[model samples]
Target: MNDTTRTVRLSVDCMGGDHGPSVTLPACRSFLDRHPDAELVLVGTEQALAPAAGWARCRMVIASEVVEMDDPVEVALRKKRDSSMRVAIQQVKPDGNGVTMADACVSAGNTGALMAVARYLLKTLDGIDRPAIASVMPNQHDGFTTMLDLGANVDCSAEHLLQFAVMGSALVSAVDGKEAPTVGLLNIGEEAIKGNETIKRAGELLRAVSAAGHINFHGNVEGNDIFKGTTDLVVCDGFVGNVALKTAEGLAGMITSFLKQEFTRTPLTKMVAMLAMPMLKRFSRRLDHRRFNGAALLGLRGLVFKSHGSADALAFENALNRAYDAARNRLLDRVHDRILATLQALPGAGTTAANEPPAARHAA
Candidate 1:
């Protein structure tokens, strides 16, 4: 290994993804080829995982079942004991013979089940009301923005938002190399009185949370502010944020398609396209949400990441790198101290992590 790089063990769900192991195998192979020290653990039935195992060096974890697209979370966790997703999560138990979550576990499978499994296996940190899904997205200035709760929580409290603020701030710091990130509350308008009651309450809570001198709170920002590079971090409930994220992705795609048509309008334009294609490809990849698809189930006791179900191999590699970064940074330990301290100091902020980890219950 090089001086700047370290090895990271990653668990990949072989049965998930649009093309399953067919596309995933090549992506994993590409990643392993480039990253000599990286190791992969493939989870699925032997039949599904075997082909990939043949071409690349990987551990084949036997998973007798899989959660189909329409399967309910309850049924998958309860009835499907041998499911690929379940077996992968079980590895988090760390029985001394295998890798634990101190190494990260990632899935491009049923997101709900993955979240449930992580919640069950790794558990949440002390005083973290709900763990969030944080996505790193494009910034106009050749950088990225850290946005959270992209479908993790539907309804949020001021307390929950405040907690997200701290975690999200830490995330931007860790991934974006920003020592202190400016946080923006995603609202209808860039004003305090613009959002609904829940958001308003969350806003007030954010103000109080910011007063502690921890997060650099920038008050409110509209969805349009994301491209303006107005803030380093954007915070909101999963529903609105998820919609906004997907919309942005669709918009990016549409813009790219429009540019292609524009460039194809004439023979000279075609020459311009040929010359600019490489740069455009790089720019498009940089802006693709899936390029930054992995989101840590923040506030968890150990490493747990959720990637886009539609993620490809490049996206998988990105997720793996992200998980490695989170674990190396000791996110769990930091979150524990920050959350407990924040809660203890706040009004009605009163829960604590139990003696036993939440990994078991969330799994169920």
Candidate 2:
């Protein structure tokens, strides 16, 4: 457990997303209202973040630039060195006294740029070759299933997958209060020989670590298993995880759209819609993607969370809340400690990596 007495400070990029300060400012205000022990370092242009200047427990950090939603990774890294996205991430870096400005960072910026800037600034934790993004998806059991590599590293080796599993487990255990979360290798079938060579090897590695008491391995799980809540965590490469996330969002939208269409299609159909309104509302709320807006960039030396580029005030607030929860639980320490312990138990497994670097851009 973490000591609740310490204030959890967060750095926020107020000008990164589509709506920019219009959306982020309100979210930050709402977050501060709920968390009396939290402080915010608002990073953006002077004029852009002027409104937050008077807010108590908040500090304004001037950023001359903003990373647009369509900005390329190279431009964000080289050209826009003073971008709010970059500066916000910088808050997590320790100062000359080894004291960090913020406990974590939250941004609704270009996913690729955020990941790139965060990795370049914080670097990866020891034994972690690359950082991965982990987020939760609503499942059937009235709970969320944690999944990782959600578009950070499109191509992953068996060892990289093992690293993701270790980081993801720490995330769940820290935030969700799960002592030993079960891990499932996302594959086409439940059998050990179902996936490609990389996945098969990953499964073997997961089993080895599980037997050594480092993780709780639940063998293999198919795509549908993710929605079934069959496991606490799902491990996969970025390509698959991104596709799955977008597909789930699309399905939710479709269901809500279909209901709207039926409500006004005809008078007789309208009556049926009215009868089902209560249940429909419940179902729609269950699938709203806004409730699960924050995605954690794991394996970094510090904590960084990415919110949807188009998130509104409510969604962005949820992202801030999630980051606050993780920080208060000492998520960074948990991830680093878990990785080190697991790697020490199985030498030559977590530190090794493939020759190719991660892709230039993550999935938008």
Q: Give each prediction's root-mean-square deviation over alpha carbons.
A: 4.3, 5.1
How many clashes does each candidate structure show, in the order listed? 4, 0
Q: Model 2: how far is 231 from its true place, Å?
A: 0.6
Each candidate's TM vs. the true structure? 0.85, 0.94
Best by TM-score: 2
Q: Encode model 1's per-residue lDDT on 69-135: one tens digit a residue.
A: 5677887768887887777766555544333632556667777777776677656676787988888
Candidate 2 wrongly placed segments (more than 4 Å): 348-364
lDDT of each: 0.73, 0.89
* lDDT of candidate model 2 versus the reference: 0.89
For candidate 2, the per-residue lDDT at 104 reads: 89
